[model samples]
Target chain A: MATMTIAKAITSGLRAVLADDPKTLIMGEDIGKLGGVYRVTEGLQAEFGADRVVDTPLAESGILGTAIGLSFRGYRPICEIQFDGFVFPAFNQITTQLAKIRSRSSGMLSAPVVIRIPYGGGIGSIEHHSESPEALFAHTAGLRIITPSNPHDAYWMTQQAVACQDPVIIFEPKRRYWLKGEVDTESAGRDAFSAQVVREGTDVTIVAYGPLVPVALAAAEAAQEDGNSVEVIDLRSISPIDFDTVTASVEKTGRLIVTHEAPTFGGIGGEIAARVAERAFLSMEAPVLRVGGFHMPYPLAKVEEQYLPDIDRLLEALDRSLAY
Target chain B: MGAEHLPASEFDIEELEQSLVTSDPADAPPLVQLMAPDGSLREDTKYGHYAAHLDGEALRAMYRDMALVRRFDQEATALQRQGQLLLWPPLLGQEAAQIGSGTALQAQDYVFPTYREHGVALTRGLELSKVLRLFRGVSNGGWDPRESNFHLYTLVLAAQSLHAVGYAMGVQRDGDDAVTVAYFGDGASSEGDVHESMVFAASNQSPVVFFCQNNHWAISVPTEVQSRIPLSNRASGYGFPGVRVDGNDVVAVHAVTRWALERARSGKGPVLIEAFTYRMSAHTTADDPTKYRELAEEEKWRERDPLLRLERYLRSTNTAGQDFFDQIAAEADKLAASTRADVLAMEAPDFEDHFANVYAEPHPLIREELEWHRQYQAGFAEETAGQAEGEAR
Candidate 1:
């Protein structure tokens, strides 16, 4: 076991996997010499060599398309999309080719390719650098989406995504990259789709994922001070959500609030709310409330805080759900 | 005077024939041809070595593959017209391009084909009937690429070119000599995906071949609309070799593709092959060619029919007896009958199967959706019960 930042844990996990598997390859722009903008892939190119940690051309479509082909050749390619906003260039390949290849081939072939995208807001970064595109992938079929909140989950979830036969998109919360936690190097920490109840309480359940996890925890602590017991759930897997866990929690609490940095309209929170309503409708004390960014393009740094869901916003949603 | 007011000149058959193959007359790139339209064997010194392996046996086999593929393509079009299939993309005039380039590859080599490579699928040994499953709307992917090392047909324009480059890169890293080839149309050359793939292939020196069948049309748009210059010439800008072959001539196509694959396999990097053929049929079964193209232009391409050229060569060489030609015709018929039977026999997949393989692992969303579907299906039970009661009354 080692204590490391979420970024280091991910690097360690990727290193462990790349060292273990000869077929696994790392490819992206600036991933080789620069070791990634966040330095998560630092020291890896030195260890793995250029063949393993490849610095691709400045084209996202080329990166993903080629990764799909490499997957056909039985190579597990880990493609790094430099930023969340830049993933749109490869959207056609990711959605049409990588996502559909397995089902299209009737399961004879699978693209065990992991597309790593550093997503979400709160870093006060420039436009296109800080945007949450999870809902886009989560809404898409034939894609497995996962996001980890802490180092332990980050380290393990990455390996799990690589092990997955289908195309897995890892939406790493860029703002949470420096958050440190204990990660087990001896084994994988948890399943990719399982949601963890980070904080346990009774009155209401606040579900969050990626960067919003810290906000959820802070909101839970604030709610405790306000004399309301609010449970916080980290949705590790955004696609095949751990609805059983969420349903159980919502049933016990009889209230739920889903939060994220993505737009409130047609976001993943809406899907979670709908699913929870379907499964635990009678148990709900009120309509599932959501706390997220407004329905607009992610604003620039100066007003990003107001656009993003913070502890105040989470608590407000929680208080509303509980008051019902 | 305007051409509409002036009397037309008497059309000369020989002049028209000369014009079709001449670069100056059509303002098109000169096509690399091995066998002339008259079936006479003429050698091009540059590409002769690649075709050295094409003996009588190889020629006969290529002819057989092309014949059967054409028959199967016709049957699929008929099926679509009969409402059995949702749609069909006919690989009508470019048989030589598909069969020759497809057959030239070694077993270890892989192909990424666009939606219209029916002949390539046949050459690669996928069931001719299985190819119709996608058009029939029963399967998401028509056949397993693993079985033949020919990937599923990509409907998205030029997407497969990137995949092919990537696969070729993989082959290079593995220290293997296998090549990867992607097949797309002339119009697909305009896609950014193709440009990116070429750039990546050139930079990495990836072992890939971009095989573009310039069949002269992309639905209603002509090939000229896609590129002002020859599509092959674009490869030079990408820093790679490019060759324009007579797509209607199977012998030349096989030789050219072999040469490109050799370059790629030997780690010389990617090559672009422009197969100058024409689309003899409509873009697909659903299209109206009469609205977009001229009958006179269609007649010009018909005179240079790929199958007729091959048949002429076989006869002029005395390589195939009349009985051999008869056997090929019989085989094509048998293929059509069997393919039609297989297509007719194919049942629609269970509705639940749609939700089954969305994820390799069982997904809760899929499960929830499947369950909801089950209840929705159960909603029809009361109607059946009421019908039974009415009968009893």
Candidate 2:
């Protein structure tokens, strides 16, 4: 086990997949020579050569559309959309084509493609850079949407996503790229679609994903001080969410507070809340409260923190649930 | 008199037809056509190389493919009205255009289609029930492309053209003789991807056939809005051969598509075939053509219907008898009934089925979510049990 930043873990994960499969190729704008804008793909071009580590044109749609073509031709392509906002150009390819290709073909063609996007606000980024479009991909059928909260899961999940037969949308929290954690490369389990309970408690269950996992952990830690034991679950897979861990935690805690940086309306949080309400009605101490951004679009950088759900807001929601 | 009317100088129909058959640059006016609209063959046509490829059986099969597709299309439209389907894109008048090109391909070839290519999909062996799922709102895609070598129906206009070009590039990489055909409408010709596809196909010398069905109207938007010149001429600018075929003429479509596919297979790059077809029905079950266009224009096109033209040709040649026509009609009716039954009987996909294919490996979050749903559903069962006990008390 070694301590590494999320970027390093992702680099290592990509390296592992490349080493494992000769057919695996990574393509994106600046991903080959510059090692990606965030350098997550650093050293891959040199190690894999130009053919495998391709530097595509500046078109997001072109990148994804070509990736689909490549996938159809028996190559597993891991495409990186430079940033969250930039993914929209490729949205048609990803949602209309990549997502539906497998089911559309009635399982004849499997688009074992991974679309990696650096998402969420809080790095003080401009417009289009900070938006969360997970809900859009999740809403579409035949696409698996997942995000890693830390370096360890990032390392394991990225490899698992590459190996998966279906197209996987892997959203890495851009702001959390620098955050470091001990990644047990040897013991990093290869579970691709399940949720994990990071910190266990009994009073309330706090569900978060991607960038908001650390915030939820912090909120849980703070809630512990006030004699409230909060169980925090990291939703690694956003779509087809691992509801078992969530429901078990909710059943034990009897209260739930879901959090995310994306808007509350039609968010993955709403799906979790609705599911929990139906499943754990008797066990719930209070209605599932969601700690998320406003229904409006992601705000300006100055007020992004206010718009995003943080430890304070999450803890407050926990307090309200405890009061009930 | 209206925006629809253009001066005589804008388009010379005779000159365009003459240009279609021959490669003589001096005599070839920008477009290519080998057959006249009145079912007359043109002299000085460049399609001699492909004339031997079409036989009696092949021609009849192409006609049968079109007729069967038209019947299924009418059934689908009726189904939409009956509320069995959410919507249906009627390819009513464009049968000859699709079947001509669709039947021209080898079994190993790939086709990237826009949503309304029901004729093409049928030729590729896609079951009618599978196509129904997409319109029934039960599934996004009705069939797999790999099995039949046909790509899924792309709904986002001309995006499939780029996909086809990319696939053709892959075909070139594999050193394969298989070609790819991209089917789209004139409205799709306006999209950036279509232009990009042409450029890429030309630059790469990729084996692709860009078959554009100029069905006149793209929803409420007419062909005039999509292009200033004919759609076929746009390919010349991209450094490839472009031809405008009488889309209603099955013979023209077959000859042109066969030539294009053969050219692609032999590494001559891409060829654009603009089939001058007309949309005989509304764009979809939801669209009202009367609201946007004049009814008189539709009636005029109705007289030159592709099916009728083919039937006339078949009868004049003494090729199709009453028994053969009746047999095809019966087959079409049987197919429609079975398709409707199969579609209506399709069970709603299992909720857990959603989690199965998201990833090849089990995702931790999805596992938890499935468990959560199970527990949640169990709670409902517990409530039902409690309700039963309460009634007993």
Candidate 3:
């Protein structure tokens, strides 16, 4: 058990995985000597040496492509894509090679690779820094995408992603990287792929992932002031989504509000809304609503907050759900 | 004279001949010729070393693989015309280049391919229906790479090259004898990934083979724009031996690939083999070759067709009679029909499949999303039911 920020928790988790498995390696640009731009991989290279903690060239595609090849050769490589927007250059390798290699191999080989990217808006970053491309990866078959909203999950899920046989895309909310929590290092509880109920309520179910999970929790806290109990669910896994928890909460609440920083059209929120309408239609007292980014490229830094789903946007969606 | 300014010395031909088939190091540049197009033996060369490896039946099998792959290429073009597929990249004349290098790989060796290597995919044992699904927009990749030791088909040009080099590095780290072969077109030779792959492979001595099929075009761009010198000459700058082979010659491709593989396995390092072939069709079904290149260029390549060259060589040697040719043709037709049937029979993937394999362990957000989707779906069903009840009432 330890109290730490999400950044520290992730580093600790990486250290533990490296210690446990000899084959586990961490490779990324600036990860070796610079300890990553966010320092999530701080001190890992010095502790593990350059062989295990590699500082590769400034090539995202090369990092991921190599990681796939390494995974094929029985080494579990955890690749860091540096930033959310930077991951697109490697998207071809991820979608075409890493994701499909498993099923395309028809169970003959398991990729066992983890691609870590710092995602979402709110940091007042430049263009291409706060985009959400989770829907793209989630839509692709044979890939497992997970994002941790807190320190506890950041610690546990990082290890779980490293251990999983399939290639896992672990999206860490860059904005929430500093958020602190108490993490039980010994017990990761359920696998990192399942969703976690962060707050218990009965009035409405709020679903959010990555950075939006913390925003949803804040909204739940604020909603308590109005005496409207909000159930908040942190979506740990984006693909192979844990629907059981979501449906159970929706069944109890009778209303749902899904939130994400990505565009609403064909977003993971859309997928959730359609699924809920199919399975929990009779239990719904109000129509499911979504709070998401607009159908535009993630805007420049100045107006990014407006482009991202914040507590206010989530609360607004909650109010809409209540009206429905 | 400065070391750099020295004229490139002519390679010793005698040394090249002695080490042509054997893995021994000769003073010559790597064995660049094992079988000439004329079917006549190189008198000064040690052709006996590769004689046992080439059989009449095997040559015919290579020919059949090329013909069948070309037929599928034609069918895919037709399907795209009929709106069955959104796009198709045809490998009409580069059959021998793909099949030869593909067959050269051992069971353990891995392959990294670009999108146009459908012939390579067939040789790697991928199902035809699975390959079609990618173009049909049903899936991003239709088959597994680990089963055949073949990576997924990359659409982005030359991206797979870096992956191959990285995988080759892993092979070195694991102390494995397996080498990785990266298949890319001449246009990809100009991409940054290809250069990075060569540099990394050279620096690390990663066991990789760069198999460049110089089919003369990258969409609208010609080969000259991509390279001023021959593509093989580019490898010398990367600190590895490079060879040019008649890409249309299956026997030559096999020999060169086998030699490169042997060198890589023996820890001799990487090699680049440029298969100088031609693309008989458009780059993809969406492309129009007539808009860019002249008809004469196409006609000239047609005369040196890879399939015809092999057929002529086999016939001149009495290795393939009419009966053998007919049998192969029948087999190829059956393969095409079976492939079509498989494509038609492929089941539409289930909706839940989208949520199933994102991670080895269950993710909380994914669980929530999946549950949310179920509820969302159920709501629609309920609405439908209520509407039906209202109508009945």
Candidate 4:
């Protein structure tokens, strides 16, 4: 076991996959030589050579489109969108082509590609750099979206995303990139898609993913001082959400609150609330509430605290659910 | 070029094999014209070298292929009108463009085509009936693209250019030296995907041929509106060679496409061939060309019909006789009739197929949706049972 930051874990995961498969290639703007904006891919270009760790031109559509083409040639291409906001330039290719090729060809073709993007808010600086756009990709039909909250998952899930036969998008939690945790590098890795209940409780259940996982755990610990029990479930898989574990938790807790860094309006929380309500209707003690950012573009760093969801908001949401 | 850009492929997926069926060649560019509308041979030294493979028998076969595909297109259109198909995109006047370019490809090559590549599908040996399953509403796409190396028709404009480029890049990596063709129309040049696909293709030196059939109309929009200049000229801007060919002339199209494909397969980077052709038919069965275009314009194009010039040349040279023409006509009719029967008899797939392949692996959401559908379908039996009990009461 080794203590490492989430960024280092992700870099290790990328390194593992590159070593495992010669067909695997990494391409994105500044991913090579510069080692990515976050330096998550640092030292990779030198280790793997420029051919495997490629620095692509600045076209997001071209990155994805050519990646899809490379996938056609039996090359497992991992495409990195330099930032979350920049993914929009390639949105048409992602939605229309990347998401449909497998079904469009009637099972004759498979686009084995992975798209990696540093997503979510906190480090706030630029116009479009910090945003949680997972909902947009989750809504797309032919994609699997995953977000890892800590170093261990960042390590394992990155490898799993590369190993998946279907197209996958790994939305790395940008805020949690520097956070350190113990990573068991020897383990084969857990099922990357399942939701893990990080804490046990009976009064209420707070579900979150990616950057929000640690926040939810803190909320649970804070609630303990108030003599109220709270459960925290980390959603590893974003698109095909692990509702099996979530529903079981809701059945036991009888109350739920979904949280994320994305705006609550049409966010992934809505999908979770609706599904939990449908599947665990009889077990519900109250309407499943949500804690998320305000309905606006990610704010600048100065006031980002007011816009982001923190422990106070999670506690407020928890109190409302328990009061019912 | 910007840092984000690579030198793009020529023409935005807009190569069509040549001969524009226009009586007014006065406005047409000096393309690699091998056959004049007056039933005489007119060739250039460079292009003539490329088409040397077109002996009398080969020329006759090209004529037959064009004729048969045209007939198949007509039958499919008729089926759409008869409510057997959802819609049909007819490749009426652009037959020479599709047939010539498609025939120029080897079976090992991959093709990414726009929806109107019925003739290309024919060249790749896809059963015409199977191609109609998409139009017939029974399947998402009718044929296995890998089996024939012909990808499913891309309805969206210029989207396939990137796929073709990436596939070509793959072929380059594998050292297979196989060609990949991306087919689109003049209007598709405006798409951002096309821009990026070209850049990626050129940057990687991928073996792709951008075959843009400038059929002069994108739905109701004219080709002139899409570009102020000829589409082929756009290739030079991307730092690749582009050529204009008479799309109405099969020989010119075959020769140009052969040269382009050869250059690509030889690792000489990409080529863009603009077959400046005309779309004689409406965009699809749903369109009314008379609403936007002039019948007089149609009449003018009809005077320089692709089949007419070829037939005239064949007759003048005695390359084929009445017996051969009669035999081909009969064969075309036989194939169309059988295809009609097959389309008519095609069954709607078992409902299970819908949920089965949503993912290569089993998915919970799909399985749940499938169960819901099954229950919905089974509700009728429960209602029938309830009705019987009520009647007995």
What are the TM values for chain B, all candidates? Answer: 0.90, 0.88, 0.87, 0.91
Q: What is the lDDT of residue B31 in candidate 4?
A: 84
lDDT of each: 0.88, 0.83, 0.82, 0.87
Q: Estimate each model's TM-score.
A: 0.93, 0.78, 0.74, 0.94
Top candidate by DockQ: 4
Best by lDDT: 1
Q: RMSD in angstroms, all models?
A: 9.1, 8.2, 8.4, 5.3
Model 3, B1-393: lDDT tens digits are: 001222344356665566645332322343354455565433214323543477888888888889889888877777788877889888899998899889888888999989888888888888765788888876666776778887777777887788788788788777778999999989999987788788767766779999999998888899889877788878888788888877887777777788888888888788999998898999888889899999999998888787888887788899888888888788777876776776666666777766665444445555777998999999999999999999999
Badly placed stretches (over 4 Å) of model 1 are A187-189, B1-30, B375-393
Which 10-residue span in candidate 4 chain B carries the lowest summed lDDT? B1-10
What is the Å distance of residue B103 in model 4 from its true position?
1.3
Displacement of the residue A228 alpha carbon in candidate 2, Å: 6.6
lDDT tens digits by residue: candidate 1, A93-131: 999988887777777788889999999888888889999
Better of 1 and 3 by TM-score: 1
Per-residue lDDT tens digits for candidate 4, residues B107-224, read 8999998899988898999887888998998987888888888888888788789889878867866779798999999889878877787777777777889999998889999988
- Residues B1-393 of candidate 2: C-alpha lDDT, one tens digit per residue: 001223686478886766655453323233344445554555435764565566667767777888888888888888889988899999999998888788888998999989998888888887757878878876667666677887777888988887887777677757788899989998888887787677667766789899999999989999989877778877877778898887887777878889899888988889999899899999999999889999899988988787777666666677777887888899889888888788788666777766665544455555776898999999999999999999999
Write one digit per residue (lDDT tens) for candidate 2, span A75-184. Answer: 88899999988888788888877776665554567878899999999989888899898998888867888999899999999998898888889999999999999999
| All candidates in order of lDDT, best leading | 1, 4, 2, 3
Considering DockQ, where higher is better, how would the candidates rank from best to worst?
A: 4, 1, 3, 2
TM-score of chain A of each: 0.98, 0.98, 0.97, 0.98
lDDT of 1 by residue, B297-370 (tens): 99999989898999998988888989998999999989988988888988999888777667787777788889
